[model samples]
Target: MTIQFYLNGELRREDAVSPTTTVLDYLRVSAGKTGTKEGCAEGDCGACTIVVVRKNGDDEPLYEAVNSCLLILPQLDGANVVTVEGLARDGHFDPVQTAMVESDGTQCGFCTPGFIMALFALRQGNEKITDGTIHDALAGNLCRCTGYRPIVQAAHQACQDATKDLYGELSPLIPGEGYEHNHQKFFAPQNLSQLAEMRTDYPKAMILAGGTDLGLLFSKDRDPLEAIIYTSSVAELGEIEETKDYLEIGAAVTYTRILPYFERLYPSFATLITRIGSRQIRNVGTIGGNIGTASPIGDTLPCLIALDAMLTLYSKTGSRELPLEDFFIEYRKTDLKPGEFIKSIRIPKLKNKQKFRAYKISKRYDQDISSVIGAYRIEIDGLRVKDIRIAFGGMAEIPKRAVACEGAILDKEWVEDTALKAGLAVTTDFKPLSDHRASKDYRLCVAANLFIRLYRDLTDAEDLMEVVAA
Candidate 1:
């Protein structure tokens, strides 16, 4: 197959013979662009961050940062890509590079390229970049030197330069010709039918979207996935639509795109989504990828379950929709049949009287796995609970709804006593196992306390004081 795309203002194409060839490998070896470093081969580290520009129409391009390691070679077809080395022109540093150098941002400079590209994507008009924004922008890039203060300063300084938008005139990078590899072949399907047909024909072929999770197979598990199908070029899988009743999020829609919608609908879940990974991971990681991975500790699952989300699965035969909870079967397993792929996630709009909240407890504030996560949705009529849904992750073999706890809180008034009793009832639903991150007892206690906290906040007694003699 011939992979054709724009590469750093140049139209290029490569003949790709093997499906196992990654975009990172193609960039470093074939294109001789080594600025994109390989930190974790998996998407955990943003050392391989690169900007992908897709033509929206004839005006400005739609730019996004993605992990290069997870992408198959064929996915580069019809797209424009920019790497760290491509930022400068005529042997001169771009504003971002100048700022980083002036600010002494690079220590062990391996991760600098990724950071530069991340901040580059974040730059828009003359907007004032806040400290929080800088922190969030570079969250994916890990500096071993821990010298983030200067790097963050560089990001702020770069935004002030007028030359920041010089790259707007640069030509888009495009892939060229056929690539040769070992035995397997890669396919870049353009339409949904082509993707479905390919999947139907090759059920065992590894489906690659934003390689956030699938990339881990190469680094951590060391699994050899030769036959590959890249979904990045499929236009239909990337659509997002919002109607009066539900929001339909396509399977390939990245977390960065969905964050704003989730924030508008369920504000509480936004915090958890922001901390799912780093900005680079979130930029490339799809909600569908998280659901497809079927990890018990995935931060999004509990929240989605609490919101009563539904998933649409499509195959060559037809499409089927079911509640998100029904998709999980057991540990590291799902109910998806052969040749079927997740199409989109449909979440109903919250009612006026309903409340939704999500809480995540991790060892560190950012870039860490969850020790335990809890998401809740409750409906109240005057002081009595009309309905409630409680879901938890890292507490069982799968992210599950605590039906017993929900039953205990349903029809009950929002009060401390009711919260306490309901919290205790959660014990009947899950007995969390002890792990290095947290003890079983600690998880249980925290799970119960989260309910109590939610109840206090809902009742407007969150800061209640108790009189004591001291």
Candidate 2:
């Protein structure tokens, strides 16, 4: 079978390239589109950013900026891709490129292509242009020279004027085609039943969603797989359903698609989501992928656990529902049975008098792994704590709840003294490992101090927590 996609307004049908070939390598080696550079093969750096155009259910075009290094050839099968080379027409540059040149945003020109593509996505988007928006859009792109002043200037000028949708009139391309090359098979299922059948057949195949993490095997480690089951194409897995009781999110739903819901329902969670990665990463990454990784420091795990989320696991025979916390068994492992895949996550809405707050502590503000993340869902009655749930990451083997810490604050008055007592219980909850991001003592100290911070945040004591000049 052949992998078909539109590369720079031209259709590309290929059966020769390996199924594991990354879009970065394909662009540079096979297609000879060297304009998209590769700085870090991993998704951290934005040097290999590319714009992917796909149609939503309403047939409206959504242009997303994603890391090409982490994208496999089959992942772009039915989308329209635009690299830096595609930004010119009739001897004229795109507005973003022109703004970059006018503002002198280029320094050594190595990271220029990535920045231009990232800013190009910003210009095409309908978001209100502001300093914060520009900063959030370019957070993934790094510039060693020619500081951000000129870049910010260019963003203000270029993104202020809205651009017309170029791919709006085009019909949506049908994707979900199985591809095989170099003895490797890739199954892109169109529905959940097909996904279950593929999973039952190729049980050992690596299940790929956004490929934000698994793509590292191909792009960075050069690991070859016998088969892969792509879940992003399954129509059932890309849905977001909201009910009066809860919000159900499909496993294949991307972060960009859920950010709006989060912003409205969980504002603090939304703030933490923005800090997960740049727009490029969020445009493709998914919460289900984060939960599937089962990492101790997965950003969304603690928040979801604190919120009492439930997971629906699917198999060829049937399906079952399990609590989110019970799914994680050990380090880098889960309770998923053979041939079972995550179907969707059901998160109950916050009831009256209950508020949710999440805090992520990392070295750098953006694009950095967490040292310790604390998430809390608390319900208060007068001055007493009615009920509370606290979950922490980077403090144990899996994203686990602080059971001991929660007990300390339960049935107690919501005051500074009670908060301090809970902080002491955190030391006994878990003994974290010392890593490059933070030390064991630092993690413990921070994890405990977060209780006080949360108390200050909920009690409207922000003035007292502020530091005074010596």
lDDT of 1 at 394: 93
Summarize candidate 2's per-residue lDDT along 1-470 as a digit string, tens digits: 88888888888889898899999999999999998999988888799999998776687777789999999999988789989998887798888888989998865556889989998888887789999999999999987655888888999888877865474234256785689988899999999999999999998999999999898999988887989999998888999999988999999999989999999888999999999878888998999899999999999999999999999999999999999999999999999999999999999899999999999999999999899999999998998999999999999999999999999988898888899999999988899999898999999999989998898888854545552221
What's the lDDT of the predicted structure labeled candidate 1?
A: 0.81
How much is the lDDT of residue 258 in candidate 1?
Answer: 90
lDDT (C-alpha, whole model) for all candidates: 0.81, 0.90
C-alpha displacement of 306 in model 2, angstroms? 0.3
Quality of model 2 by C-alpha lDDT: 0.90
> What's the true lDDT of residue 437 in model 1?
91
TM-score of each: 0.91, 0.97
Q: 205-262 in candidate 1: lDDT tens per residue? A: 8887877777766545656565677676677888899999988889888887798898
Provide the lowest-lDDT 10-residue window in model 2.
461-470
On TM-score, the candidate that comes out on top is: 2
Most accurate candidate by lDDT: 2
